[model samples]
Target chain A: MTSDGSGFRAIPRTAAQTRVLDAALTLISEHGVSGTSLQMIADAMGVTKAAVYRQFKTKDEIVIALTERELGTLEEALEAAEAEPSAARARELLLTRVIDEAVTRRRAVATLQFDPVIVRLLAGHPPFQQFIGRLYAVLIGDPSPQARLPAAMLSGAIAVGVMHPLVADIDDDTLRSQLLSYTRRLVDLPE
Target chain B: MTSDGSGFRAIPRTAAQTRVLDAALTLISEHGVSGTSLQMIADAMGVTKAAVYRQFKTKDEIVIALTERELGTLEEALEAAEAEPSAARARELLLTRVIDEAVTRRRAVATLQFDPVIVRLLAGHPPFQQFIGRLYAVLIGDPSPQARLPAAMLSGAIAVGVMHPLVADIDDDTLRSQLLSYTRRLVDLPE
Candidate 1:
């Protein structure tokens, strides 16, 4: 639960908040942010809408929390990459962790990334903007005019690669290995 | 419009149907499939819902038609690629055209590809399935387990690259060139 002067908030959730997020994430995956409602999250948890409201006053809050929680998973990896002495090593460490997380939560990750509501939210939200800035800084270094497209493509490729229907049958291990390899090639990392 | 034996129907849309599809694409880009309604489409088009319904009976049909229309843009490219004698040349031709189309209608293209409702429709609809199969076959040759991930990543990267906020400010020409360069790198295409 802290801000690192980059608008990065590390607010830890309470047990009830955790339950709401877990339920909300599942529903959002199936129904999307626009299709999902607060009531749906409540029903999924076998609770009243009021209970869900107590945890998150609005669907927007729930959406923000769910997104923050997903992004939070990458904080440690970002920090670890920041600690690395070599820029290349930092990029490698962060990319490896990113691929692992994307594969592990393939469905939820893609759902969150591609959902129009969530995409708009992330772009306009200061905290998310800051966190993502840090992420790309670590993954591809400072975004120069030349660097931006590759950075964008790298993130998009990995996210879409894991959840793509063509790769739906790909076991996590094979998918992860191929993703890392192709990702490295994209970013010019050593094989 | 005609269907090749691959279940890829090429039914030509009428003028009124074209207008509905255009309006629906704009709305879908902003609100996504689930959030958009016939009322919204009708309102956007300055018509009654009944009038809109005259063109497309269901939201699902609208979704399918929108998708098919988008895919139709690539039909010429796919045909040219198939006509090429060499597999590598075919892939190059298709990849170049795919990038061109993705860049030309960047917003609508990403919206169609990533929207959960549209994604589901594309997956469940047989014609879309066949068209996409033909698409990937040209762009990546085959769906051998090894080719699937790269194929998926290539499409994802280009789609996400064009629509990504990071590159939003980059003019389309610059964006297109960068995308083409990076995509070539990912697929190991000769520059």
Candidate 2:
């Protein structure tokens, strides 16, 4: 597959930019993008709003950067999956990695993935769309009307599975295994 | 099935309260609970902030009321499922109804269900906790730890399934059918 438009390459962030994104993501995960302000992020970092602004001029820019950072975590897995010869093996490899990441950020996954502002950002931004497209390609392995629902459901299941209150008390190891199994069931992949 | 903690009864709302909730839900769905304000709700309804204060004193009440109102939409179905003699039959009934509701409110479902503010409220609030307990009782039909992951995954799959970008373009009827089928698979229910 061509790397162009695939979002296979990670966006590089300067150390200062990384620090700004780190603080912003914590607040955004708790308060959401609209609820979070550059001032709050600055305060969280013990820096001035202008300092935060120096890295990201607007809240939307910070949000986009945060999304890119999150997506960057999966780039390696996505690339490895794409390189695999067998579709089933490719999906298995990607899903295990996805589940691991989801479990690691159980509390933040839902907000990061489902918050209204992030949802809008993901839909409107071409880079985010390209990244998601690449993820789904490995996920559903089909580009047809029939695959849309399972693809959507699987994505939802994984994102929601990690963060749902019903599973809140579940330890990460158990939650991760469960997410992998149930998501596999949703897509009819072999265990 | 004791009615005391079951949350089977829908919380009633006055006409004015309903107007506040309607306006609040619209705005909150666009901007999350933390992002939405009483003043915004008032402006959306073209009413003074004092007028909104008369109906509900704080933004928390509006959010709680919105959750109750959303749950109220499924009270009848939840009740029917509770009354069903067969466990499998009850799940089928509930899943179909849940799928229908999710399809109907595709855009708002993610925000209402997964927003960090709502998630915290649902977890910490007794009534919401009870309402969700009743829903899960019919959903998993078991209280074991084994059921936790599937329950969480099923809940996530449905909420995310309807609202996820991949399924955004699919028609409601088709989306509903797909959600029901895939969710049933996630829970090992027959199609």
Candidate 3:
């Protein structure tokens, strides 16, 4: 992972900062990044805009922080996959975690992943680019250029699978099991 | 397909109307629906806002028209698949057309699918909803609730696969082939 020229350092956030990020994420999910304002975040948290501003001075900072916090959830999972002795074991570990997170934060995760503002932010952010590279490395194992499509498709399937309207009525456990089973088929993992 | 309560009627557009849709799609792909306005569409089309307004009275109508034009592309494919003799053939036919469309208009397709405003429009519009349901029916073949997850995941994989940054550098032919191969595997279709 380190050899990819993208560092995997943890983004540390203070408790107060986390609170602001939490409120911002909730509002952003509903109104999107462009529509969300600091005042809205403050109102959601029942705090003055000044208090929210004390934690993050700008909306861009809050958006970046929220993105980092989301990516940070996968950090431990990435490390666990990296440490595994076998490639297959590593993929299994990482995918299990990815599915779990997707199911747990279904709406918020999809909103963030697909939001136009967030998409632009993630693309330009080196840390995010690095984190995504590491995550894909574990999932697809540095495939040839031609093989990148399947790798991309595999990740896409998982990300969009959880929040897809067809699966909206499905409970977490059933969605998790079916996703794993079908994903394994896509990736040619053993039963 | 009509028996499914969703009629597959073609949306007729004049050359001038298509010009507006083309300009609107281009801007909407870049700025999204909410951020885009009639003035931007007029600028893109080298026409006055009144000229654009003459074609469509409001921005919502333009958005809906753009969406209808896009979905209309799939109507033929869906009809062909519906006319197929076997379930397997229908799935294969539908998937092939889907991959082709996804690769051909990679950016526009993804931008429309994931855009929040477009998502809301699609959900609220009966024709779009009917078209999607018919599309899914062909893809999944009236699956039990447990089976909807794979169906959703399969569709998501295709939708997101072409637009994924990982495969961004890959050409259309390679992407189409790889997506088909992996999607076949996921759906248990014989390659």
Candidate 4:
């Protein structure tokens, strides 16, 4: 996890860290961070706790790694959004990728937002703070406190819209396209 | 516990049931339905678990009661929206009430979406299902599954946004105002 231009600290990963992260994310998504334990993760992966610990020193570390891995997938998009010539373009580009990634990952995104432990982790970490700022920057495109609600709504919509029990009947292709179209309207995107 | 709407089936509540529900919602919000046992609810209310059982037969009953209490709050607004002559007016009224109810009961609204048992409860219940459908009818104004994403996002933004670590510095007034502003954007409300 390398920092995007925004100086957000993302943990760059090795292949081993990647494997640990994949397993951790799966468990965390379903069971939530508090409900999920390291032992459960090891059992899920058929590994010993010691082996898992070698990859991440603590549950906090595992969470960080998992967050970093998820963010890492968005690194290219983040970079692109930052490099955009205008804020509108940045928001547009980010929204596109957000919808695409959301459709691809679906349930995982919804799960991440609701995990109390992960919520705490994101709150307490400076790098996570910076990364999230960068994320909102692209998501809402303004620093105005006034933008907070729209940003919140946009963020909420992305997380909940794709994975909602309401959307279960929606196919990925339709879900993706409809999400983008509606989101553009929400964000004031030009047709 | 009764179906207030959404696809969820709500348990019918009498006046006696309402007392048990109020106590349960407060406890469950803080502890989560799974983490919140009947002993905890009874302890919180200065009663024994058997006393709790007398009101409701099991933990499932309490969860249904708590959910119904929350959903019931929405029924008035849903009815008002349904009464509206126009889609735009219906969405407007529903949006305002949603923002108000969420802000007034910030903690409950925020926490309910994340609880494992509540999450499951809301999904399986039929009255909840119908209530949710009616609520969404006023909210998105169209049944586009694609349109559903923004609605979901808007819901999430209000529930999680004001409570967000990023926006912690924001006062309640600022949070509420900003959230309302941004949600309008997400739903493409007129400027």
The sequence of per-residue lDDT tens digits that candidate 3 reaches over residues B1-191 is 12244564547778888899888887776666766889989998888999998888887787777666666788888989999989999999998998898898888777788777777766777877777888888888866896688787887898889888887888899888888988887666888
Residue by residue across A72-165, what tens digits does model 2's lDDT show?
7998999899999999999999999989988897766765787887787667877777878899899888899899888877887788777776
On the 0 to 100 scale, the lDDT of residue B42 in model 4 is 85
Q: DockQ rank, highest first?
A: 1, 2, 3, 4
Predicted candidate 3 versus true structure: per-residue lDDT over A74-160, tens digit per residue: 888898999999999999999889888888888877778877777776787787787888887888886678657878788779878
Between prediction 1 and prediction 4, the one with superior lDDT is 1
Query: TM-scores of the models, in the given order?
Result: 0.93, 0.92, 0.90, 0.80
Quality class of the docking in candidate 1, CAPRI style: medium
CA lDDT, every model vs. true structure: 0.83, 0.81, 0.79, 0.72
> What would the C-alpha RMSD of candidate 3 be, to one decimal place?
3.5
CAPRI grade of model 2: medium
Candidate 2 has a DockQ of 0.76
Q: Which ten residues in a row have the lowest lDDT in candidate 3 chain B?
A: B1-10
DockQ of each: 0.79, 0.76, 0.62, 0.43
Q: What does the lDDT read for residue A91 in candidate 3?
A: 90
Candidate 4 residues A3-121, lDDT tens each?
45444434667787778778877776655565667788888889898888888778887776666655657777898899988888898888898789888888668777666556756
Instruction: Compare the candidates by lDDT and give the number of the best one.
Output: 1
Kindly list the per-residue Cα lDDT of model 1 for residues B38-145, writing each as its tens digit.
999999999999999988889998887777676777877888898999988888888878888888888877889888777876777776777788888877776688
